[model samples]
Target: MIVAVWTISAGTVMPAAADADPPFDYLKVMRAEQMWKVADGSGITVAVVDSGFKEVPGVRSESVLPGVSVMSPPINDPDKKYPAHDDVEGHGTSMTAVIVGDGTGGAPKGLAPGAKVMPVRTSLGTTMAFAAGTEGAQGIRYAADNRAKIINLSWGDYYARDKIRDAVKYAQDKGALIFTTMGNDGDANNSGNLITMIPGVLGVGALDETGEPMELSSHGPDTDLSGYGGKARIRCRENSAWCVRNGGTSYATALTSAAAALVWSAHPDWTATQVARVLIQTAGGPVDGAKRNDWVGYGVARPSKVLVDRAGEPGAPDGDPLASPAPVKAPAPSQTAAAAAAPAKAAEAGLPWQWPALGAVVAVGLGLGFMVTVKRRRG
Candidate 1:
């Protein structure tokens, strides 16, 4: 969550196959593209809350929505114009590129190209990430209210702020599937990340090229899941042909969001609970056959197992096995309004809470026992 200080050393890799999109080893390893033939996350909108965003060539500008900036005074790039992009420090764009980029001219192709992105720009890298928490809180709420169901929060702070927690609750109530990193301090501290303290927010780790947990990926009971962490391609500018290879839970989180988008788009009627359940069920579990481990939680995502192999069952529509009972604690009285008003608003129409319809056909004969009637409803 905390990108203490960022220096964009985006070393561009050489171009390959100008006529075709270059292959991303992570995608192939995860088999994420296997679902594109049937479902490519066409109707899902994932909100990426981070530094800023700019649509590069492989990342379609049309698919990127006109998102809002939550900066206190609002950043104005006098060099350009109003909202060419909220801000572009390269990090946010990189995360966005990993989830939805189309892989044009050797650029990175996101896992879910058919899905749209709603960028929520905040002052993440320019200042203390704690300060961005205030803006990120609002950004989360805004994204939830504006048709974004799959929300990605790639960064986090060390402390849990009440406003952000409340916003997370608000978004989850609106059926938002929130994803965040488990922090890069695994080898250093092994302490829990800010995301672990929040309920209904998934804390994701990363996996290496060998499909094992990444060495730097944080672990523990709070680690919800894992995703591909091998080198991923990213482009900083739109017109540039150069791309950089990067890896981390940030892209892992993005890939998880893209996986959710793929499942959600394929079964539009499924609730957040159903999509999440299937993802966890279909994921590649530990090699030892253990149910779950602190290192990879339930294991790395294998959405292909569901869409391609016709595996994993979507459970109850309303049941969320990962849903925490209640994590929100005391908040300053001044901030009671957002939390107080949430239930009232959440009660409004959101994710449909209906059970699957069941039907059966039966044929009945009269007392005379005359046969010759076919029951059309029979299956």
Candidate 2:
């Protein structure tokens, strides 16, 4: 399959215009060099717990397994099924496209093109209320119980929920690797100040082309690694045939999820902890530089490093893999200010930002701009 590649320019930060490179050459490098040749996701099932999903060409259709819908003011039809997944606001489509999209019809390619995607519509916005009472915790439980090995949570809140935490723990016990964004608020948000729990979570940070942390990529206690989450020029959902650049930790989370699939697909016997360890141990870039800043976390993740590793050979049955450790020094009090204010993509407070047209979503079969409707799919 043809995949796009993205390369980081000289420094950690690039001009906004740099996001427009065609074919995303850097992404191609990662897929060609870092990605495993084997179909590692042969038996893996990933749950993309996010907003509304429209049946699209590149994304998994039948593999887009049915789950619960918690949309508020729901879509009125309960029995209707669309031919492709519609992207109401373009957020969910971009995310899922990066995970399991086939890149057909010039659509952006996904990291794990072969894996099954179980789309669960959560809350409409960034919260866990799009679909109603089905919260993040519920999504976790559903994926775990349904034999999903990987769970991708592309949304985040400043504080962790007890219900969500417990559900994550349960998923861990059942052998699921849960990957989530560390809140896209680094260059300007208060996510770092909040207490974070690392257990049962592989918190991911955002990395740019140069393999450095984006100014807005949040960093904190639980941040394990960074991924390509930047303003990138790719296919636009408005037309789905033109180019539109986008970036954020949301994209990074999806990339990381696909990375985990690569490792897990290669070594199905490894535990979630093991898969996480390999990522950390093999992460590329400057680990020492980020040691002082909680905002950047452990720097950008380079699966290529782990892919080429001769130390812990792939498929080796040995001691605990998660035990691979890298010593770090905490940041000074002055450095903590980086966590304040708005990151690059955070919607400006009260800015008159006209939202995108909701028509494309309907065309893709999302049933948008209609009354709330929930249809129960009986087993």
Candidate 3:
């Protein structure tokens, strides 16, 4: 069973390009700057389960926790000398910057500057290859065990495994809110895929500056909310002056994770479910008064409204905001046929089947069409 991790890269960069000014200011649009005055996501730990993370200008070591690697060659090989927190593909660095960057050295400020990042490396090398199912499941469990308040999965695939589903349930049981991308395929009916369709995980879609869904952002009923995922600025690597303008559902997931962190930090007593509910209820509705849509889910995530204005009602502490209707139970088979019928019935009940795909793992990054270049490091 092969699973490909999806990521969008803008290309390589040189040192001098970092000096250029940013093309857009996402903080102003999302009202993150105003929200920061009330809460900066302090005391919240967001587990970035991606390629890895690097110590950059805005992302300092004090804000990062010791993390583990679940990449292939070995699921949890302690003997591997490579640093688990290092970003070989620069994808994790970008996501990390979006979550906790401190805006030092002229870098763009992150949504939750006071938050701490827990890096969980699940991919290796520049190509971001890994033992997809095993490593991903291990990574999720590790983040939950480490007491992460939020888990950010910036990568996803069409195939879903029982191990991964069980791991997601484990995290939810542990009170960790999980967020994942809705993919970049731009398909109209993107609901049948794995990862995003998994119960208890919030699927995020990308939104452009105009508050409409990005043309490339996947649309599906599973998309819980939208965020600024188009051409958003993010740090490339440690000690780099240039930030890349990349767009994908991965960025949406990261930004939403930061928003969750902010809400959780401000209301430390709130359960993961309560925080999720606030985000959904307080999201900016469309001009037409339509509460929900597949293209942008509940609408653009407006954390500032929740934090600054104290808007939204966190209904039930333990209620799942994205819970699907209960599945109908099939009648039990006769004693003799029960054993043979159980597996088939479960399969027919929407159990995920493994499918092979090229590229065992992938991470999102900036693509071409921009003048700035991004320099990447591989270990």
Q: How many residue pairs collide in each prediction?
A: 2, 36, 16
Which parts of model 2 are misplaced by more than 4 Å?
1-23, 31-34, 60-63, 72-87, 126-134, 158-160, 192-198, 233-243, 285-293, 308-379
Expressed as tens digits, the lDDT of each residue in 1-379 for candidate 3 is 3345555333332323555655557787667767888899999999988778777676778878888877765446756554667776777877888888777764557789899999888763344363544677888999999999999987775444577888988988888998888776663333323576677788788765444456567666676777877665655544244455655787888899999999988899999887887887767543334455565666556777678878777766786665431211212222333223334333332321110111011111122222221111110
Report the lDDT of model 3 for residue 98: 81
lDDT of each: 0.63, 0.52, 0.66
Off by over 4 Å in 3: 1-3, 8-16, 74-81, 124-130, 187-193, 235-241, 323-379
lDDT of 2 by residue, 1-379 (tens): 1111111111233333323444244456464334556543556677876664666565657556665554443256656542224445445566667777766644566777777777766553433232322355677888898888888876664333566777877887787888777665554433431212435476666655433455566565556656776555333443243244545677777788887777777777877766766665555423223231243334445454445442234323333333434522222212122223224332222111100110000000011122222211111
TM-score quality measure for candidate 2 = 0.68
Model 1, 1-379: lDDT tens digits are 3443222222232433334333336666556656898799899999988877865566789878999877665346434332526554666777777778877755577888899999888777565454677778889999999979898887766544587788988887788888887655554555445654576677787765444455556666667677766565654444244344445677788888898898888889987777777777766553234455566666566677678777667767765545422111111123233323333222232211100010101111111112222111100
Candidate 1 has a TM-score of 0.75
Q: Rank the candidates by lDDT, best first.
A: 3, 1, 2
Residue 15 error, candidate 3, Å: 13
TM-score ranking from best candidate downward: 3, 1, 2
Candidate 1 versus truth, CA RMSD in Å, comes to 18.5
| Model 2 error, position 361 (Å) | 40
Q: How do all models score by TM-score?
A: 0.75, 0.68, 0.77
